[model samples]
Target: MKKIILSISFIFTFVICFAAIVADLTGTWKGLIKFGDQKLELTYKLKAEGEKLTGSIVSSYGEIPLTDGKIAGSDFSYKIDIGGGPQESKGKFMGDSIQITSTFGGNSVTNTFKRVAEK
Candidate 1:
């Protein structure tokens, strides 16, 4: 009986931790990507509701609404259409930072984003 109780407690703790990890993704994150010799800054304003994620990717060009966003544990994925085509990005949410890999035209680039503190 004691073993069973301990196991149940462990499972409950794991479930709560898993949920909180995903929930922590909400807020602003900033990163930079380089195109040849030029570097462009990217900002993400993310909101997570359960497994559904909604956000906007802002840059000097303009703000692009994120689509088809999903989150599970510390992993997330989202899509953006920039007229040329729909670009999909997959990332892992690390504490205080996130690493994202985006593919376009048969090329992939990975960028690391740091979480921005709210004012």
Candidate 2:
């Protein structure tokens, strides 16, 4: 009986930890970029398979594929090509929001994204 109880406890702990990790940024997200006095809204559709992530960004410029996407704990990072310019972004997930810092064309930009419900 004691052994069974211990096994069940371990399973329960594992499930809780796994769910917590998966719950962070496991869906579509939308954000806006602000540079100096200019702002542009963008949408990111993301899918996570295990520790690997796949996504794309939709902006007025066009759709860009997210490459080399990875996630560790609450930290996430990815790279994308926007109009022939390579850019990389990294951030931490908090609740339903993620704050990311991206560098492009020798300029660093910060953005805050909110998780969007899938249609």
- The best candidate by TM-score is 1
lDDT digits (tens) for residues 61-112 of candidate 1: 9999999999988999999998987899999999899999999888999999
* Top model number, lDDT: 1
Superposition error at 81 for model 1 (Å) = 0.7
> How much is the lDDT of residue 113 in candidate 1?
92
Candidate 2, position 48, lDDT: 70
What are the clashing pairs of model 2? none
lDDT of 2 by residue, 8-75 (tens): 99999987776677566777889888878988898888777667878898989888889999887778
Indicate the residue-level lDDT of 49 in model 1.
Answer: 90
Residue-pair clashes per candidate: 0, 0
TM-scores vs. true structure, each candidate = 0.93, 0.79
Alpha-carbon local distance difference test for all models: 0.94, 0.82
For model 1, the stretches where C-alpha displacement exceeds 4 angstroms are none
TM-score of 2: 0.79
